[model samples]
Target: MYRIGVDLGGTNIAVGIVDEKYKIIAQNSTKTKRERGAKAIVKDIALLIEDLLRKTGIKVDEICSAGIGVPGAVDTKKGVVTFSNNFDFKSTELKKMLKDTTGFDFFVANDANAAAFGEYIAGSGKGSDNFVLMTIGTGIGAGIVINGKIYTGVNGAAAEIGHTVIVKDGIPCSCGRKGCFERYASASALTSMAQNAAEENTNSELYKLCGGDIKKIEGRTVFAAIEKNDKTAGEVLDKFIEYLAVGVTNIVNALQPDVLAIGGGVSAAGDVLINPLKQRVQIEDYARFCELKTIIKAAVLSNDAGIIGAAYLDLT
Candidate 1:
C-alpha cells in the first residue's frame, strides 16, 4: 500500500504519493496563494491530490492515508491548526477539511517535526535514535526526535528552538520576542547581513557580485563573494556562523541529540557552512568534555524531507 504526503507552506502546496519504501513515486505542486484564505487552499490541495492519483494511475483505495505538515502550532489529536502566523490560521480544522475533501484519514504535524521524522527514518538521522533537525530558511524551524518519536510536547508546539533567545535585548522577532535566534542565523538573516555589508563596502566583491543592486543579495551571494576571497563576505559569514553556532550549541546543551542535522537553503553551502558551525558548536557545547559529542551534518533529503516525513506520519 502507498501513502500521501502534503507539505503546506505559505508559498506552495506540494503533494506526493509515496510507496512503502518511502520514495515519492509521483508529485504535484501549486502556489499556495494564501491570500485567498484557508478554505480555498484546502480545495486546491484536494484537486492536486486527485490530479496526482490520476497521473500515477493509482486509485484512492490504494493509498492507506494522508498526512499534512503545516507551518504552525497544530493540535494533532484534534487535527486543528491552533495558530499559524504565516497562514493567519486560528483553530482551523485542517484535518477534517482535508478528509472531507479527499475522503481519507489524515494526520497533521508541525512542518519541521515532519521533516525531522523524515530524516530520522531515511536520511541523515537514520541510524540515530535521538536526533534534531534545524531547517534554516526564512526562519529557523526545528524538530526534536527522542527514541524514535517526535517530541511535540503537551501542546504539540515544542522544539521551537528559533524563538529561544540568543542575545539579551537584541533584534526583535515577529514572534514578539527580542533576540530570537532566527533574527541572526536564518537564511533571510544572512541575506540581510550581506546586503548591509555590501552597502558599507561598495568596493567589495560582494557588491560587484550583486552588481551594486542590494536587492539582488541573497544567501548565495555571500558564498559567491567568499569564493572570490572577499573579506567583507568572510566577515559577514563569520558572524552568521557564530550566531548559528550559538543556536546549535543551545539545542545541543539541552538535548544532546546523537545527530543534529542542518537543512534548508543555506545548508546548500555544505562544508563552507557546516565546518565552521561544527567547530563553534563543539567549542561551546557544555558537554565538550564528553568523548561522544553530537555529530553535526547537512540534511541529505533537502526539500523532500518534509514530504517524506508527512507521508509516514503514522510511524510517529
Candidate 2:
C-alpha cells in the first residue's frame, strides 16, 4: 500500500503519495496561509492530500497511513506541536487535526528529523544503523538517528546541534548565546564572512564579484570568487571551514554516528566542501586513532528528503 506524507512549512504545505518502492508517485502543494490559523492550515493539508489522491486515481483504502513533518518542537506521542515561533503554534493538536480532517492515522515529527530519517532509509545514510544529517542553510539544523531509530529525546526536542557553542565569548547568536556553532559555520555565516572580507580587500576578486557592494555578497558569491583564484576568498573559506570543522568534530566526539551527511545550499559545493571538512575532522576528531571512522558525505535526496522521510515515519 502507499503512504501519505505532508511537509508543513511556514510558507507552504506539500503533500505526497509515496509508493511501495519509496518513491513519491504524486504530489501537491499550496501556500500555508498560516496567518489564517492552525485549523485553516490543517484543512489545506487535507485538501492537498485529497487532490493528490484524486489526480493519481488512488483510493483512500490504498493508503496505509499519513505522516507530517513540522517546523517546531512536537510532542510526537501526543501529536501536539508544543511550540512553533514560525506559526505561533502552541499546544496545537496536529495529529488529531489531520486524522479528523482526513480520516487516516497520522504520525508527526520535526522536519529536520524527518529529513534525516529519509536519508537513513533511502539516501546517504542507507544501511547505516547510526546516522546524522546536518542541513546548513540560513541556520544549521541537525537530525540524529541512533541504532536504527530517530532519536527524539524525552521532550521530543533533541539534536539541536547548531545552538551548541564552539567559541567561548565569540560572535553573538540570535538564540541569545555567544559563539553558537551556526553563528560561525552556517551558510548565512559564510555569506557574512565573505561580505566582510570583500569590504576589507578592495582589490580582491570577491570585491569585483560583488561589484564593491557587500549587500550583493552571497554564499555562492564566495565560491565564485574562489574559482577566480582570489586569495581573500580562499582565506575566508578556510576560516569558515575551520569553524565548521570544530562544530563537526564536537558532534562526532559526542555521538560517533556511523554516517554523517551534510545537506543544504552550501553543500552543493560537493567535494570542495566535503573533502576539506573530512581532512579537518580527521585531524581534530578524538577518534583519529581508531581504524574505522564515521563516513562523512553530502546528502543525496535534497528537497525531497523531508517528504520521503515523513512518509516512512511509521517505521520510527
The TM-scores of all predictions, comma-separated, are 0.97, 0.97
Winner by lDDT: 1
Residue 153 displacement in candidate 2 (angstroms): 0.8
**Predictions in order: lDDT:** 0.93, 0.91
What does the lDDT read for residue 148 in candidate 1? 92
lDDT score, candidate 2: 0.91
Off by over 4 Å in 1: none
- 1-316 per-residue lDDT for model 2 (tens digits): 9999888877778889988877999888899887788888888887898788888899999999789899889899999999886786899998998889988888999999999998999999999999999999988999999987899998878988999999999999888999999999999999999998999999999999978899999999888988999999999999999999999999999988999999999989888789999999999889999988999999998878889999999999
Please give, for residues 1-316, the per-residue lDDT of candidate 1 as tens digits. Answer: 9999999988899999989988999999999998887899999989999899899889978999789999889998889999987887899999899888888888999999999999999899999989999999999999999999999999888999989999999999998999999999999999999999999999999999989999999999999999999999999999999999999999999998999999999999999999999999888999999998899999999989889999999988
- Candidate 2 lands at a TM-score of 0.97
Model 1 score (lDDT): 0.93
For model 1, the run of ten residues with the poorest summed lDDT: 97-106
